[model samples]
Target: MNENDKQPDGSGGPGGNPWMKSLLVWVCILLGLALFVTVLGGPSATATGNTVPYSTFLDKVNEGTVKDVTISREQIAGTLSSGEKFRTVPIADPTLVPTLREKGVTIAAQPAEGGSIWVALLYQSLPLLLFLGIAFFVIRQMQKNSGSGAMGFGKSRAKMLTQKEGRVTFADVAGIDEAREELEEIVDFLKDPTKFARLGGKIPKGALLVGSPGTGKTLLARAIAGEAGVPFFTISGSDFVEMFVGVGASRVRDMFEQAKKSAPCIVFIDEIDAVGRHRGAGLGNGNDEREQTLNQLLVEMDGFDANEGIIIIAATNRPDVLDPALLRPGRFDRRVTVPLPDIEGRLKILEVHMKKVPVAPDVDARTIARGTPGMAGADLANLVNEAALMAARLGKRLVSMAQFELAKDRVIMGTEWKSLVMTDDEKRMTAYHEAGHAVVRVHTPASDPIHKATIIPRGGALGMVVSMPERDNYSYHRDKMFADLATVMGGRVAEELIFGHEKVSSGASGDIKQATKLARAMVTQWGMSEKLGMLMYEEQQGETFLGYSQTQRHNISNETALAIDSEIRALVDGGYDKAKQVLSDNIEHLHRVAKALLEFETLTGDEIKRLVAGEDIDRDAPGAAATTVPVSGTSIPKTRRPKGPFGSPAPQGA
Candidate 1:
């Protein structure tokens, strides 16, 4: 039979659910009828006038003889002639009628007035009574089983994914090569049982998949089940729990037994830590039922009964809180980490998702991968889908590189909040502010070249200048940090240069946040501050939850923290002042760029570069920046200041 045919009847296994309880009650009823029949008389007897004449006949006759008998009711008489007759004596064993018939006695019948009322009532009501009883019992059991709508406290909340139902194979799973290679071996072992058995290698009872959510840990489990071609039972750790005691333990037992029956199968429990958390780590109420569930899970996993062909695969993002017993050698013998996709992995993921999308010739997976650093598989998938949707909205046949870029921006910053109203003055100030950023970026030596700039509002920003890296870069130098800070201050400086102290909106709020963080790290974290002199104030402690760190820095005292904060603020202020000075020196160039923005709403990096070099940025103007001058493809490169101007070495140093 195919794997699909082997799906256990959804009570999740071959043994039907609690319907057996109803069957048991029915069997008892049938047995009761049989016993009553045996003690009363023989099967051939029939009741005569509510009295059984068969008792006397049974006492007097041998098993093989015909007999005559007389039977009487309250107001009627009946006679049976078999060559002899006696006075009518009525007795009360109505069940003896069959026995009299068995002796070959002929009895006379009186005209019937009414059928036996009690017998008729029982015959008519038994079926309905049995049905109602079974139904009520089933409802009660169902309610109790589900804990009256409360999942029992001890139940494991893992999700089940059966092999036939979940269709993810290695091809379907993208990214995370190391995790896939490790799990592929499990699938191989399951597919060829003897290969390991001949070597006397005991199968591991469980393999724990540890990683952050959206890293494809659960997806890996599904792929294993698909490759194994066996029953896959999926459940979440929380699914096994309930408010009632013992339910989680019972579920564990049931799950294990089911896995054993479907030997050579995979049982995937996602988020196993819900029930497998360390004991006594909680508020330590001795009555805590999670502890019981965890204890039972340990016993089932490493207990005396070897879990022969059943392989348990579980996933948890929170591995730190898992019980030690659950991670013991005999229990979860292997742990496979599914980390975020690196650059190459991200590219591969893009390709996998790209096959489903109709993309333009210019849309390169490599280009998208280079843009999205530190993105997980889930995010990459979203990027591809978003690009397709964007193309559709623009009435394009396929997604182009432009669509991909726009989608990336949408994902990074939220979608543009277009309806937010701004005055003409605010818009003009925003134009100058963004032009300042563009000018500083193009003029900065260490900055990545600007790809595009826009004064059109997007994601709560009145304008933005995008400067993407030329290729994948893992590390940033100190020069890059300072250039980044200068770019951040470009807007504020431009405002001061053009408006001469007119109030500038807090359009740079987010920029200030980003710049300040980088600056503080330069001082306290990276020790790039000259006054601090290479002494790291906060040690490079990584991978904390949110911003909460377990590794406390020893050297950073209250006084030091204050000093660090002061240094960071001073660094940002200094960068801002430098940007203002640059803008002051080039106020005329700043106005030319802003005027072009207010007119065109957008401009390319090349066009803005010419305008900075004293050429007309407007297409209608004489010697416009767009008008090509016949010369070599390149020219004398100007010596521009760095973009951030001191913002480097701090954020990326570690």
Candidate 2:
């Protein structure tokens, strides 16, 4: 019998004979009933007469009180003259037969029964049979769990996904149209290979999906399989590697063998970088087990034997670490980049997720998408789910726009720390700090437009000033970097101007840290400083291995490093001076905005502008009439700046 035919429960597997399983079950039940009858009936079978001592039996026999005697090997049974029966163990005597004859006692012999012998044999062997059966069962379970029944240690762990219901197709996927288009050709090839073959085009052997995490790479792979209506096999890269050497290679061979049986199938290996790292990149010839596995994978993918109908799709965020041989043309012919969604893609993703819930008419997908600039499809799904959760928590019938706004804030800015209490003086100081950021952003020509200012504690910040870009910007301009540096320094500048230099608090530490990082990036990485020229002063280092540097080749001299530091410091100082000037000139406007924040705890950009123009805001009314403040000194051009949700690290006071 094949090992695969045996099940863990000692029953038959799918391919096994059904009648055999039924016969085994019936045999076990009969054996149990027989054992139960034997145990319960054994003691009562000979429990009929009274047991007497040997002396009493002999005395009775000599007195002729015993009428008949039935003698066995161990004991004697007899009937007395009073018509009572008794049994006893007898002592051997040479004259016993003569005495019984003299007494005229009828003598009879009792022999062993054949049925008792068989019953004894069954009782003795029952425990042994039970033990053997249990051992067989446990071994079968172990084999089944090892993945291969007889070939235990070397079977592929890839799971075949038979999407009977809720199968994902291209229609279910959003926010990654380009990636979908790249894999669509493979689907078409799988469905009808002749269309491509007529044009002398071979189907791509493999396609590598490269993107950040949560960018829907794996989902796209599944969509391809669903579109073609073929078998899908999925596994992780880590599943191929094991502690024992050669096991991974064996598994790889076995995996391809299985895939061949189900031709025209899609095999997805998620996070392929785990086993596909560059060979000999680590210390002392690198990992032998992983390297061997990767070699086997490369061969099975595109080696001597042509795998005609199998399409391999792998997903990994760390494409830089993968081996080049595995990424060659014949192996992975196409590299699809699944990037973060743009505004329109985000809107589509939101709309897709929104369909799953009951949303009010006031909830706008475009507005939420605009607010979330760098979010991926997964993030947008979470955002919609969060809004629904918030609505449900409030016991509302439908998810409204207010719930979405709150959910967005919670996701971007961290949950509001409502339990954190602040004294009046601290609140006042935080209000002033955020007001400084708002004023600087409003007056700076190249800065992004301010979205909201709040004194409420969120995440690690005591207060935050959020800015939103008019549109997505890929590359950063020098003016925008300078504007960002100045904006970050505004909190410290405001504190010094309002509370005096000696009374400045440590709440500006976060702002100072943000400013330093921005300035250093501008000078060393972005090449924005004139003194540093347009050359990159800092080298991009390779990823670390085992807490040690993989490549530490610093070409710059000590003097050059010192010069770079000086340039970064100069940039930061220039930003501080610029912010000081801006805040000092708009001192009155700063106070007004701060007072409004203290009153409302949060204020929108238009409200801040209205406050600057000496207009009263009606808290109860929407779109209250307000006058626009004209720009006087700096020419505030409406240029776009790329800023993430809550401005990345955010312009905040710690």
Candidate 3:
């Protein structure tokens, strides 16, 4: 037997079936409910007044106090002159009725229609009718939801979208031209399947779209559907699996069967990793429904003949977890990758969004694209929306570069937190901290250009110094890494130099973490340490912290471990000293930038550059230092800054 074929936990071996426990519990509950309703129920409305002997009833009737009487087969009910109602057992005497008629009392004797027995029966049956009606309604709803009955869990739930359903064509998609071209071929085949079949070629049965989330997987599928102008069926991976076994398998069969009826159609399963994971790896003890569903999907995919005109496309971010059988040649003929857009691709995506909104003459989508790297199509769309919102809040006629800059900041960080009041000392410290980062970046030739600097408390940090490349950067040199480390450490060095080491705040905690991480990567991952040579001492997955190891067994000797630690400390210490020296020499320039920040509370990248260069601004001019307000962050904006060299404006303390 296969090693993985071992019985799952609680599969009813020697320990007994787990279902027996649940069945026993249900039985106990039913018994308790039955006892509660029968023994513990309260009194009824007809159970009032005490029973009297037939002789006493006859005496009361003779006294002429009895007003009316109702008689049944075995009982007699009557009302007195004082309007009190009473009931009593009837005696077996023919004289009873004649005696009542002889007196001035009115008497009634009837069948089931209006007798006391019939009234009691009607009241008793009403509650029963009400309970049965409710039960019937609940049962009908369950059948409607669960595929005709409890056993219909395997019914198909794929939604069919015609051309009018959010009709997205190839023109609506951007930032993935290569992927679009590949999908376009599929559309062509669908448009005219005979074109390829006549040449003795088979149409591709399936195309797999692999990418990170929000990178346009679903949009691409829709674009294909719109381009082909055929029925588009959409279903998620989770829709197939249910608590009952074989349901997912049934749904898979049903989904394909429905799609086949519409022959020239596209079936898209989004996030198929939910059901397509490797079989037999789950928390369940016995047969798993997900595996059954996956097996059914594989059979259906394989069952279809070539050029049958029913195409399947599945999307998943986790291609690693998918079973290899589903990815074989005949099943998935094409695999397309959709990654985050590069600079040019970002520009195209921005232009597409830009066309939908009103923009000023100064707005340049290409320039914005150059500033934004490592952003997906969805992220760009969100950026455009944020920019338009900012413009409208500012009451501007058109979307300006200024609004775009603020939107970018809001996206990268969080909404501005200007309402958080801070003391003068804290603000000064924040200014110096960011100035230190900016100064070190400017002096190091290998460092990225300083795009902006601010003392405003945005996101969780008290301040931030942003570094941007002229264009999208793919590779980094060793010297650049060293420079980056120095830049990260400079803030702490600045605080220690100015406020004394003991007075330095814990705000540098994040900075120390970043610097330590970079230094350790240099020694262990990058092989920059001469003592370590080109060999890797750590495990396959590197650590998140410097000098933190993940291996179960020690790969290196005790002496080598000590040496690795020594190298990491040496790298960080060396970078720290480099930063100190730069700050000491550029103390005057740092003060100028801080002074400007203290007065204006914020400065754009252009303004920072100008300030650092010792350029004099018209301090008294109209709107020379006007700050834009944060319109909707609960805190009214005291000032707004313009966009900087990076796609958005440089943020000061806005």
Q: How do all models score by TM-score?
A: 0.68, 0.84, 0.78
Global lDDT of model 3: 0.75
Best by TM-score: 2
Query: lDDT (0-100) at residue 465 of candidate 3?
Result: 71
Q: lDDT of all predictions, in order shown?
A: 0.69, 0.80, 0.75
Query: What is the Cα-based TM-score of model 2?
Result: 0.84
Candidate 1 Cα misplacement greater than 4 A, ranges:
1-166, 193-205, 283-287, 393-396, 533-536, 539-558, 585-589, 604-654
**Candidate 2 segments exceeding 4 Å error:** 1-47, 83-85, 90-102, 113-130, 145-148, 152-157, 162-164, 242-250, 280-292, 395-397, 501-503, 541-553, 622-654
Ranking by TM-score: 2, 3, 1
Pairs clashing in candidate 2? Answer: none
Error at 203, model 2, angstroms: 2.5
Model 3, range 419-513, lDDT digits (tens) per residue?
A: 88989999888878777787787788887665567777777667777656677666557787778778878888888878898878887776676
